[model samples]
Target: MTATLQPVLSADAMVRDAAGRAFDDLAADWFRSEATFPDDAARVRKRQALLNAVAALGFADALASPDAREAWVDAASILRAQARSAAPIDMALLLATGDRLASIAGDPSLYECAADAGLPGNAQAVLALALGRCLQICAALEAALDLSLQYVQDRRQFGRPLARFQAIQHSLAIAAEELAASTALTDLALACMVREGCASARLPGLLDAAALVLGHAIDVVYDASHQAHGAIGFTREYPLHRHSLNLLRWRDDLQRLRGGELRCAERLGDAALQAQGVWSAVTALMQPGDRHD
Candidate 1:
C-alpha cells in the first residue's frame, strides 16, 4: 500500500533570514581562526549549530504535525545559507533531515504510514529543491571565470599584465569553455526537474548532470584562479584559496565513493534529442522488476 503524506500546517512566516544570522556568525567565527575549514573544529561546530537549529524546527517530521510546519519553512531557510556556504555540507544536512522524517513515518502509531516510503519521499523532495538552488550557484561560479579574466587584463607579469601572454590567455579560454559547458548542462538539468516535476527515477540523471558540471566547474575555478594570481593564490591569506578548498571538497564529495557513483549512474544514459526523450529513457531504465507496471 502507498504510504500517505501527513498534512503539514501551512506556514506563513519564513525563518530563512534568521538562519542566515546563525550561518554568518558561525562562518565568521570559523574564518577568524585563520584555519582551513571542514577540518577546523570551529567550522564543524558551526555546521552542527545550524543542524541543531533545523532539528528544533522538526523539519524532518513536518508530515507528522501541523506544528512542524514552521520548522519546515525555517529549515528551508537555513538550508539556503548552507547551500551558499558549502555543498558537501548540504549532504550532511540531508542525511540528518532525511533520517528524522524516516523515523517518524516508520512509527505507525505516530504518523499512520509506513516509514519505508515516507523516508525516500521526503529525501527526494528536499534533494530536488537543493539541486535547483545549487545549480544556480554553480552557474554563477562558472561565469566568474570570464570576470576573473577581465580583471587580470592589463595586469602585469614582471611589469606586463598576465593577459598579454599567449599561454595564460589560452588557459583562460579553455576555462571559459569548460564553464560554459557546466552552465549550460546545469541550466538544462534544473529546468527538467523544476519545471517538468521530472519523475523520481530521472533524479539520478539530473544529479549526474549536476555532478559532472559541478566537478568540472571546480577544476575551472581552481585553475583559473591560480593562473590569474600566481603564487599569491596558494597562500593561506588569499581569499581565493579559502573558497577553493570548499570547491575541492565539494567536487570530490559529489563524485567520490560508491554512493556518488550510484547517484551518477542514475543519470548516465543514452543520448537523445529532446529533454523529454532523455527523461523517458532514464525513467524506463530505473523501473523495478515489475517493468511493465
Candidate 2:
C-alpha cells in the first residue's frame, strides 16, 4: 500500500495544535529534572498527573466515540505526541478510562468484558492500545537513536569522535533501518484497520505483524544504541536509559499481556497458507467489501 495515510496526515496537523502544544509544555515542565530519574513511585504519581492532563485535552473521550475510525485516529495522535516527547507515562493507560481503566489497571472484576466491549465491541479500543503502544515504541527507538548519534559525535575515542568510525556508522544505520521498518509496519496496520474497520478478519494478523516488527526493533535499537554509548548510556543520570528501559519493559508487557506464547508468527504463517500465498492474503485483506462477517 501507499505510504500516504489520510488520517495520519490530518492527525499530525491536529496534534501540533493546542492539544499537542499543551502535552509538550506539560512534559517539559513536569519531567525536566535532568539531575535524577524518577523512581517507580514517582513515575506512578506522574502517570496520574498525565492522565489528568490528557483528560483535560478531551482525549479521554476518544474511546467512547461512536465513529470507530475517528476514535482510533484521535487516540493514535494523542499517544504519538506523548511518545515523541519521551514523557514518563504509561502509554497503555492513555486510552483507558472508567471501567476500562480499572480493567487495564488489573482490576478485571470491575469489567470482565471490557477487553471485548466498546464502540463496535471494543475491537477498536484494543487496536488503539496496540497502535498507541507501537507508536510509543517507535518514538522511544527514535529517541535512543538520536541520543546515540549525538553521543558518538561528541564523545571521542582513537583520536576522533566515534561517529567518524565506519563501524559505528554501520551500527547506527542498521538501527535506523529497524526503526523505519517498524514504523512502516505500524502505518500499514493502521491503514488496514481504518479501511476495513476493526472487525475485519485480517485485523488480528496485521496487528500481529506490527507487534512482531516492533519487538525486533526494540532489540536492535537497544543493542545498537547501548553499544554506541557504552556504559554511560545505561546510567540513570543520562536520558538514554529512560527510553531504553521503557522499550524493554513495554516490549515484554505487550507480548505477555496481548501475545501470550509469541504465536504471531505462527498465526501469520497459517494465514498465508490458508490464503494460498502472501500476495493473495494481503490483496484480499485490502479489498473494500471485507469489513465485517
Give the per-residue lDDT of model 2 (tens digit) for 1-293.
46664453244656535555765665565555432655544344344434433332234244434355555555555556666565543434433433454323422211122232332244445554555567668878888999999999999898999999999999999999999998787776666555566555666776777778889989999999999999998665777876876676556544543454278778777878999999987676555454532
TM-scores, each model vs. reference: 0.52, 0.70
lDDT for each residue of candidate 1 in 166-260, tens digit (9 for 90 to 100): 88888778877776676565545444343333343455565676676667667776777676877766664544443565455335434541146
Ten-residue region with minimum lDDT total, candidate 2: 106-115
> What does each candidate score in C-alpha RMSD?
13.0, 8.4
How far is 112's C-alpha from truth in model 2 (Å)?
A: 12
Candidate 2 deviant stretches above 4 angstroms: 1-14, 21-68, 88-123, 286-293
